[model samples]
Target: MDFDEAGKSLSLEKDEYIELVEFFFPAAEIDINKLMTANEKGDTELASDAAHSLKGAAGNLGFMELSDLARSIEERARNAQVTGLSLKIKELKDKIAIIEEAFEKHKNS
Candidate 1:
């Protein structure tokens, strides 16, 4: 959640990075919901797709923690391994919440 580092790594100014993150937050929430639904339905394909999308977006924004978590889910889903996905999805949501809190702090500053 190092905003300065993320902005530097992405070659974005602080304001630009903020704008990108503002967009990312809501989209990430949607993806998380999709992941939860996919897990509940045991739809490996849909889960994999959702995780992959979230992974890529997070990585692009230098949210490596989130990206890594999503990558695990994507890899598992790709192998049709649905076991414990609910827990993993919860972990993902937790990471997202942490990131959101950091973003809020940055905005308030």
Candidate 2:
């Protein structure tokens, strides 16, 4: 989805919107990686923290799917129900692809 509407809703000019998209992508990518590593290491607290941070940022940027999925993973980690954490991570990866696509789209616009 083009983020023009999301930007408009937030009262962002195109340039500002593009910058925000650019900024979020890199940080979100790092958070995803952190989630993966922490989950692998069985560090639930770390995983929860990473997911929670990413979720809020993603939601702010109108990436609801990513934000909601991250919230699920975060809650699961916090509740000590990380049985399918890998699947959750994979879902995040897929959501990140959509975010990447949005980034490229907005980058060119």
Candidate 3:
């Protein structure tokens, strides 16, 4: 992710950018976790809700990859398509790892 670009587009200072990212980190993590659990249980509504939340949060933070994956999962879950839900969930989880790594690097820096 382009941290500098995102911060500039959002009109945030460095510290403010980090703070905003920090605030969103856990929410996105939790929602992704919930999405997986909901998928496992065939809970379409729950999964869709979690995916929707993750999609918005990821997009807001300029995590475009995550945002796009979350959107795919959201639409699939809403449509009750469980055929490839696990794979989609796995992809979303992988994208979450990217943000987690970025957040860790930001914290360490």
Candidate 4:
């Protein structure tokens, strides 16, 4: 994700960007956790719904990699392709960690 482009396009000042990201972080985390839980329980519909929501939210916040991974997870879950969902969920979690680290760095900067 090119946050520079997103920042400029959104006219996001340092504080404003931080605030926006912070606002979404909790919900994103919760949705991801819920999605994982749903997947574990074999609730494909709920898992897909959560993943889809997370994808849109992450995309809106410029977490492009995370968004893409979430979208893939959602699609695969919707199609009942459970074989790779765990791997994809792990990837999504890793991306989320990256986003969190980036946000912390930006906050300190």
lDDT of 2: 0.89
Put down candidate 3 lDDT per residue, 13-83, tens digits, no spaces: 97898888888878877997898889888899999999999899889878888898889989988999988
RMSD (CA, angstroms), candidate 2: 1.2
lDDT of 4 by residue, 7-88 (tens): 6677888567668888888998898898889889999999999999999998887777778889999999999999979888
TM-score of each: 0.96, 0.93, 0.90, 0.90
- Name the best candidate (by lDDT): 1
Model 1 residue runs over 4 Å out of place are none
Query: What's the lDDT for all of these models?
Result: 0.93, 0.89, 0.86, 0.84
* C-alpha RMSD in Å of predicted model 4 compared with the true structure: 1.5
Worst 10 residues of 4 by lDDT: 1-10
Model 3 stretches astray by more than 4 angstroms: 106-109
Best by TM-score: 1
TM-score of 2: 0.93
Model 3 residue pairs with clashes? none
Q: Model 1 — which ten-residue stretch has the worst lDDT?
A: 1-10
